[model samples]
Target chain A: MRTALRLLGGQRFLVAPLCLLGAVIVFAASAPEFLTLGNVSNVGAQMWVLALLAVGQMFAIVTRGFDISVGAVAALSSTIAAHAVNALGPAGLLAGPLTGLLCGTLTGFLIGFLRLQPIVATLGMMIGVRGLALLVTGDGQVVPLHDADLASWLAFDPAFGLPPADWGAIGCILLAGALLGRAVLGRRLVMLGSNPDAAHLVGIDTARTQLRAYQLCGGFAGLAGVLVLLRAGTGLPTDGAGMELQSIAAALIGGTALSGGVARVFPVVLGAAFIQAVLTGLDLQGVSPFIAQIVVGLVIVAAGFLEFALRRFQGFAFHRRSWT
Target chain B: MTALALPLPVRSAWRRWRPGAAAWTTLGVFLLFAVLVPRFASSGNLVNVLRVAAILCVAACGQAIVLVLGGIEFSFGSSAALASVVGVLAVPWLGPAGGLAAGGAVVIAIGALNGALIAGFGLPPFVVTLGMLMAAAGAAASLVGGQPIDAPPSAAFAWPAAGSVATIPVPILLGAAAVTVLHALLSRSRLGRLWYLAGANPVAARLSGIAVGRVTFLGYLVAGAFCAVTAVVLTSRVGSGQPNLAPNLPFESIAACAIGGIPLAGGEGRAHQVVCGVLVIAMMNNAVVLLNFPIAAQQLVMAVVIIGAVLLQNAGSLPVMLRRALTRRPNA
Candidate 1:
């Protein structure tokens, strides 16, 4: 059971179970409806978009880089996809995600290949890409997809008596786990992230590996954008506005190192779930939307504190060496 | 040394004025806009450019100080937002001057928090400042209840965009004054020496009796002051303290300074370079505005330029320069 928990990975599992169970126990003790399957599934369904973004962000963070442009990229893909739906019918949906993937990959390439600093490079992308998104949408959102079928189905459909989006999110995590744990490219990505200099010395094309990280990340961000659009049935500017910060928080909460090298996909997936669920719970509890952001800020502070504490205890040293 | 042999000081002076390639490229772009775009050459537009660039320059200057001390700060946005929100709110009683003072003080407090966390407690600046960034943003937004507060109706505030002396924008004047003072401080003062010492090698500086932590704290304090001044100027200019005004500010300033030649790894850069960088970005934005490029076009151009600027800044030293020169010499 201990190894199961450990293998399920990192400290991510511990936090979510503890928090979710605590919420359940408290709410159940008080309201009795908190432990219901209906409420739990609702929480999972709602976390779909943010959870996807967290997966993309986890990749960037685990590779020892950061992506502040996810919000912009995601927004661009979602908005563009919606805007193009009028032209391409079902095919138009692909337009936004493709553009999003291109932008994401290019941004990653700029950071990885051009030797530009990750944070600054992504910051530039956040500015330029967001503006580009606004431009593509003519400074307005595509409020309704020309064909909203796929979006509607993704948002409202149920599969095997579970919310489709929630199940889809779980499936995405499983795929990511396979790619990262069992694939050769995944191992190379891990090596490049853990120690680029050493990887280069060992004949690994570190640059290629680095670029692939961004490419893979951007593709996911693009897909996440599509998922968001599908869920919302439209594209909104604010969709990606501050999502990067949340994504970073999600990845960190899931126990991925910010400086990159170690990863536990299941934990990050759960982390994303935790965020969505927590925010949903707060909303249900009658917390105002704006004020609830304080919770996010608090969570981020807590994560930083945890990182600092872990560093102080030298708890990460063992893991750090293994990955490198 | 023989007279024909270039005096080392003279050689170093030449190096200082060598005009970095990025500097020249950006300057060339500026000139092209001035010549090609009539509106860009107008004094009014030029002053407006200065005015806009002044906000960035002020923020970047603060950022440059921290960068110079071998760290980075993202709390500039938060500090500016907090000060802008709270300082102007105080203007009903405190007046415009009070707004400036209050803003400066609040930013300093934020800066002190960042410094204490990073230097005093031995925390990473990225984590400390990132945390402070969120906290400051939240606190400021909450303080103002997420609304805009009108600035004091003081024409005295206009002095930044256009000082009493005809034709100078107060922002430009203030930014210039700051650059001068900071430049002198970096070159002449004991504190500047300590900052340089710490930035160059924290361990060595500590070993040599330099109070590295205090120097870091001082750097952040100065950064806070710089942000405060920008807040005051921006509030005065915009005629209100909009809580979300500094949304892209931290990134803009860091990019400007970085594009100008300041490396995030720290040490071996000057504040003056940041001024040049800020001007380049401001000019680019101004030119785009003058040209009436759509927002998307602007973003694309700006992103490309940013990447180009980063590349130019990171290009190799004299040896590589010589090799390039030789390669070009054959063509010329």
Candidate 2:
């Protein structure tokens, strides 16, 4: 048991996977249908939007900052995509991400160049973007897609055992993983986050790194918006009001250090998946959705406690080993 | 000796003039609205604005305390919503006054919980408060099956919101009292000094024999008490329990504090700043409505003002690169 504890505590990214496994076990035992193919596919289909958002949030959090504006930006992108699709056909899908990139750039400018606090900058962006979305949709009305057939096909029709939208999400996640693991910008972001003073001393352009982080975050939010648009078959201006909190919770639970610098794309995705599973499992059990929300909230706090415990145990174990 | 003496008077004069940017902004916004928006200067409309500002002021005062501790409280909005729900539910059994007390206790309890988690565990304030926010909101929602619960209308129930003492609304009186008390606590009390010290530098404060954790815990508790007052008044006014009551309370309060020149980095704020910030926001909202703009326009304007206000406030501290970028000539 001691060795097991040490092994588990030794790995930085293992917490999310462990939590996911525990959730799967408990949910599978309580709700027999949780592990079934149909429900699994349902969760698979539903999780991409959140997954995309969580991954984007990870970028900001890894940089020792976070973007709360992603949800609002996604809504704005969704509305923009709806209008673009109506006017320009299938080519308009690209507009969603482009719009997101623009919003992200503005947010990045505010945080990086203007030196505004991340929370303040993102909060301002959130309000402005929500307003922009409302303006686009005219009084927060949902904008129905003209190409319903295409949307449904992309959203629902399975190719390679997954819908096109899910495939797209997977592709984006892979790209994000590659970017974080391989790219020079990613290294700069991590270095900056770990120690801004040292990064500056090392000649890294800190402002530009922050700018790129927020840009990547916003771009991911835009991709999530595209997914939302495809899934809902409409542009919803007010759809993603609470998603920012969920993404933050997911990123945190996925072992993305709130203190910044440490993170992984796959673990964060598992974290999102765990949340989605809980939500889905509760729904299947006829439990109130609000109860699920409470559980999620508890899980978030529990994740914090778990992190704390692991840190303490690891320290103790190291001390004992060195003394012996 | 003359130069030093001259500088003393100049510094004092600057201090006297320094209600700071937020105060000036309030005056400017009020005057602009009075001139531009028809009927905005009318006494009745002005009273309405004050009435709205009163509730926000009380909440923002609590928010200011938390900000002064270098902590953020996102759960205020949801906790207020939960309080209203719990308050209304208890009214049938506990009566109006008793129900209100129960609701206030619930908020205080939540504040204590947040305080314990943050101070005891060394968890981030953002994480703990956010978690509590979700939990409290869920509790409120689940309690009523996601619907509003009406409290039986009574004179006693409405007294806190509607009743007047000396021809002044209770909310306005309460708002004034909150500001005055906050001012006293921040400037005159020993606990207030400790809060400031802890917020500014926790490690140094600890080394200096201050109980930093206890101070932080109390700051959150005091903030919660302030939010409770606002919740009670709001519930009294609505005469119902709402799951979605004041969802923007946290955001609006933070904005108000920021606009008032209370830096989020903490350890400095004043009661007058909270009042001035609340007044500016209230006036802007009132003016937007009076001007017949779309709801979207109101949000857009608010966003612009919030960002612009912060930007303007921090202009003096802008980086050399940014200052150069701003001043660089097109030809050059």
Best-matching candidate per lDDT: 2
What overall lDDT goes with each candidate model?
0.74, 0.88
User: What is the TM-score (0 to 1) of candidate 2?
Assistant: 0.94
Ten residues in sequence with the least summed lDDT for candidate 1 chain A? A315-324
Evaluating just chain A, the predictions reach TM-scores of: 0.89, 0.94
CA lDDT, candidate 2, residue B212: 91
lDDT of 2 by residue, B1-332 (tens): 77655767878787877757777777877888888899999999999999999999999999998888888889999899999999999998999998988888999999999889878877777788888888999999999999999998999889999999999999999999999999999999999999899887777898999999999999999999999999999999998999999888988898888888888777888889999889988888888898888988888888887777777776676667486435533322
Off by over 4 Å in 1: A1-5, A8-39, A83-97, A315-324, B1-12, B156-167, B200-210, B314-332
Docking class of 2: acceptable
Per-residue lDDT tens digits of candidate 1, residues B1-332?
A: 56745668878788878877656867877888888887788888887887788778888888888887878788788678788787778777787777667877888888887887767765556656776776677777777778887775678655554454565556777888888877877888898888888887787898999888988898898888888788777766677777776777888888888788777766657866887789888988888777898877888778867777777775664344334323422211
Q: Interface RMSD (Å) of model 1?
A: 7.8
Q: Weakest 10 consecutive residues, lDDT, candidate 2 chain A? A: A315-324
Q: Which lDDT tens digits does candidate 1 get at residues A240-289?
A: 77678778777777777655677777767767776676666666777554
